[model samples]
Target: MIVVGIIGRPDSPWCHDATACLVVDGRVVVALEQERLSRRRFAPGEGPEETLRLLLAEQGLRPSDVDAIGYAWADATPEIARRVDSALPCGVLGTDRLTETVFPTLAAELRNKEIFFFDHHLCHAAQTYWFNPHRDADVLVADGTGGAGSTSLFRVRDGRFELLDRYSPLWSIGIFYEAAAFYAGLGWDAAGKLMGLSSYGRPSGRRFMTFDDGAGEFRLDPALRGLPSGGFTEERLAHEWTAIFEASAFPYAAGASNTFDYATFATDVQETVEDVGMALARRLRRRSGHDALLVAGGVALNAHLNRRLALESGYRRVSSTTAPHDGGAAIGAGLLAASVLGEPVRRRDPADPLPIFLGPAVGTAAIEAALDAESVPRQALEPEKLRAQVAEALDRGEIVAWFDGPIEVGPRALGARSLLSSPRSRTTLDRLNVIKGRAAWRPAALALTGAGFDAIDIEPAVAGLTEYMLCVHRVGERDWDRVATGVHVDGTTRAQHVADGSEFGALLGAVGRVSGLPGLINTSLNLRGRPMVLTPAHAVELFAEAPEVDLLVMPPYLVRRP
Candidate 1:
């Protein structure tokens, strides 16, 4: 059976989205996010039409070949925009036109495929449990808002999912963090900025939100209680967030003030969120009597908090998939819909539940064509010679744009699509930030072979998620200086472990043989705020634009700007 799952609704105020998964006979054949195809970061307010079209064309399939289509939202009602002439990506269709005309056209375009809608939170839960290695585990789904609620806890056993509890959107941890991000003088989408900034300062003694795990309750200041439940205009959310922070006794730095005070606030918010997350994990573990835990939702992307849960929280195993965010929701929606229809669900290997190569693979021919089209200088080398050249480039502190195989599905760049530099170089971090147009404070991840773990101190809990770069783990104090370029201010590193015998492992091995350190600083292969380079053309474009990139490696081919 061919099952295609899509995330995001045509009528809903969500557009920088839409991810699709094509499953055949219980196995995922392809998974692609709309943002990659649209060349828009997050591609808000856009449906997966372009993405689906591209995937189908690439796979030699047609819409008529699909058995069932699953949408991520259930009963997602469209809302009237409070303001006219809005250019918000989520409101691209003009909220008024969505329900009346847009969605109908979208539904009709699917032709004869049967459509199924799954609850938003159910999809989040499914994203974790369905493909998770643990057959029976406690699952936590926390996000801005799902169809049922913002936060959901579930227990899974023998392929059966039981909801243990849910928290209303009014008490959503995700929204609170978003508010914190807004108050930090950043866009709501830049919550990860606040997380990164949190590492630079010590915690302030004040708390902006409170959580009572024993009672299963959480609250923002009572003064902000009047904010709409499950929905809020950006203007309203921003205004209320400013007012709440200003009115509270909490210590907030001047909006235009020094970095120390801003970082202090960031630290406070980060520490508080982690505290609540840990408490929730403890409660879930006790209630479900399960040793393993699977975390899903946008909040799961907070590497800092995920690290805390992995190391400090008392769970035997804590793991999350590559697409823990909404992009992964499409895969979950398909799996859940398949199960509801009595189809066998393909369980991902626990050790490697989601393959690193889920996205489209660009072949050497494609790379050659792109290089030729661009009229760029290049050379073709044997496999060993190519690895040596790339590794030697890194050893000389040159930034190498590495496009090995299929693109990575999630936000983080695994080995497949990465910009690599010597992690030991002190100035490499700053140069990388400049290359990607990222904030100087944002930290890069370290990609290494499995043996790379020997040089670092990784807690057992965090060890589980090393493959996907889901959790942050503290670098050994002794090794901190060795991998300083990849270590955050807090002495933590978001690391991706390359499995032995993989092509990436061999590359890291080459680097290790030369440098004695089996790792390099790896960031997503794209410009700052840009979607990852999805095609050879995209990679060539980025290589041409990023002057700091010294070499562009497309396997047997290499391109260097004169």
Candidate 2:
């Protein structure tokens, strides 16, 4: 069966991160995010038409060739629907708009094919559970708000999902974090910045959220909730938090000179999130009697929380997908449709649990054309020589922009699209942050080979989490000096372990030969406000704009400043 899964709703304020994917039989044929092609961040208020068209064109598929279509929202159960209708404000669900507008438009474009709408949280759950190697596990989905609510727990036995517990949007950890982000003068999408700032301050023991162990429920403080309303927005929540904080013992002003107070607030929020996440994971393990845990949704993007759960959640194994946020829901929607139509869901090989480098590949001709258009001086070298030269440049404390193979599908750069720097010097980190237009406190991640994993102090069981840099692991005190650039103030590093035979792994090996460390500080190859580069032209544009980048490595061709 051929299935296509889609996300996003046109003109909907709540719908963002538009994406689409095509599944043939049981394997993913192609997946693309609208933001990558549209050159927009999150592709707000956009539809998946561009991405859907590209997915079909890549596989030489027509609208008539697809057997089923799956949408990532508006198919909740009757009970879920009722809860959403009662608890959420008008225009928040978007079910009516999807049915009356979006679905009909899609059907007309696709030759009136059968369209399947999936429960929002179910799609998130399916995206993680179906793609992972585990046969049975407890899945947790937490995001801003889904069709039913914000948080859900499910038990997956064999290939089916059973909902165990769910919470209303009133008790959302995502919203709590967003409020904190706004209060700290960071935007709603700045959760990552808030997380990084947490490392600089000690937790003050002030609680914004709490969990009930016996009931397995999380509660938001009434003070943060402000006035009781049907729904919530970041602006309203931020205002609520502001009033509460202003009346507290330490009143917070937006542009206050005291940086420590802001850091303290971030630390408190981060600790609270970790504590609630731990409680939820323990509850899921006990209720489902499962040894493995699968996490999805936006909150799963928190590497620190993921690390704590992996180490302390009482699960033998824990895993999260590279695209755990809404963009990943497209994959899950397709897999769910395939299963519903009596097709067996695809299971990845245990050895290669994540095959997420699913974007379009760049051909050598494209690279050559891009270079010629810029009239830049470049050289084409053999693979061995290219690696040697690039490794030497990195060893000399120069930064390189590495773009190879298909574009990565998620928020992370991974190995396919990255900025490379030597980890031996703290100055390298400073230079990288400047080049990428990021805050100085924002730490960079590391890409290493299997051998480099042994050099760091990390739990063996959580090795799977490191494959996509989804979890942070402690660096041994002894080896801290070796990878000083990658280690954060908290002594933890988010790392990715690449295969020995891959192009990136070969580069890391070459670097080891020169620098004695088999890793490089890896970050996305885009500026702070831009999306990762999708095509060779995009890569060349970034290289030209960021003069600080010493080398542009596009596999066989090496381009340097004239």
Top lDDT model: 2
Error of 2 at 166 (Å): 0.4
Which regions of candidate 1 are displaced past 4 Å?
10-13, 77-109, 220-238, 249-254, 351-353, 457-463
Model 2 misplacement above 4 A: 75-109, 220-229, 233-235, 249-251, 255-259, 456-461
lDDT of every model, 2 decimals: 0.75, 0.79
Candidate 2, 394-484: lDDT as tens digits:
9999999999988888888888889999988888888899988887877778787887777566444265577778888788788888898
User: In candidate 2, which residue pairs get closer than 3 Å at backbone N, Cα or C atoms, i.e. clash?
Assistant: none
**In the order shown, what is each candidate's alpha-carbon RMSD?**
5.8, 4.1
lDDT of 1 by residue, 423-507 (tens): 9887877888899888777778888776787756654325447778887877778878788888888888888877768888899
TM-score of 1: 0.91
